[model samples]
Target: MNMREKTTKAENTPADKVEIAVRLDSELLEQIQHLTNDPSKVIEVAIRQWLRGEILRDDELTRTPVRTPVPPRGEWND
Candidate 1:
């Protein structure tokens, strides 16, 4: 059993949160390391990307209300 196999089995065990694996080749891993060495950050970015695509596919992320642009200081005079 390799490191990944162990991780997969461990993730399968019942827990409060389920886990998913993202397999990267050596070259890809090196590229990611150039940007960040934090594994949690990398996982978070991947998950966010997945959710973005899912929401877009379902048309659920559309029509976010735009916030009113803030005026320059003294321009608002509020």
Candidate 2:
């Protein structure tokens, strides 16, 4: 089997999902491994949650009104 086949054979992965490697600190990897046998699931969930928050923040920023600076009180100069 080729590299793609090996990576894409992860359990519970969708057919459309393809694997891409990511580098993580050994300490972080150990912690993740302790939490669950399937690190991919944890990473995927974390990414989804982060993306959702980012999207909401973007939407709020787009909807927020832009503040216009008020001109200093003075006689109008032609």
Candidate 3:
């Protein structure tokens, strides 16, 4: 079918050691399980990809600085 269909079908199989929750039609799940044989891996990979995107999307990482404010000139004569 389409890429999504292919991916979905390929994401339900069992791999090494990992657990993930996915909601889909039974038929779709079965199809995916048959193809991927590791649902957890599929979900893990997807989540990691999404998180990476989000991390990169937040461009404020380098723009914000945390430091104590400098006292006003009038108060700092010492």
Candidate 4:
């Protein structure tokens, strides 16, 4: 199997966590490298904050109605 196939198979594994690749700008990566040795943790935390609506773009902050929040899994009784 080639590299792509290997990556796809690994990503599909039934595990609590799976590895995936992301591309980042070289300058941004360098900045992250300077801040922490565990960049993955930083990225994960940023994603979680975004999901919780703690982070938003300037345009999004001014948008009408705003985005509706998703209810937690157990609350979807309808």
Highest TM-score against the true fold, candidate:
2
Error of 2 at 20 (Å): 0.4
Instruction: Tell me model 1's lDDT, rounded to 2 decimals.
Output: 0.70
What does candidate 4's lDDT look like per residue over 1-78, in tens digits? 776655665576669766779999999888988989978778888899999989868887787985889998888976
The residue-level lDDT of candidate 4 at 39 comes to 81
Model 2: pairs clashing at backbone N, Cα or C within 3 Å:
none
Give one digit per residue, the lDDT tens place, for model 3 in 1-78: 776666543266456444445577888778768869866666667678898874355567667778999998888877
Q: How close is candidate 3 to the true structure, as a TM-score?
A: 0.33
Better of 1 and 3 by lDDT: 1
- List lDDT for all candidates, in order: 0.70, 0.79, 0.66, 0.82
TM-score to true structure, per model:
0.36, 0.52, 0.33, 0.51
Candidate 2 global TM-score: 0.52
Give the alpha carbon lDDT tens digit for every residue of 1-78 in model 2. 876566535555677787879999999999999999989888988898898874356667778698988777784473
Off by over 4 Å in 3: 1-22, 54-78
TM-score ranking, best first:
2, 4, 1, 3
Clashes in model 3: which pairs? 9-32, 13-37, 13-38, 13-39, 14-37, 14-38
Each model's Cα RMSD: 11.2, 8.3, 12.0, 16.1
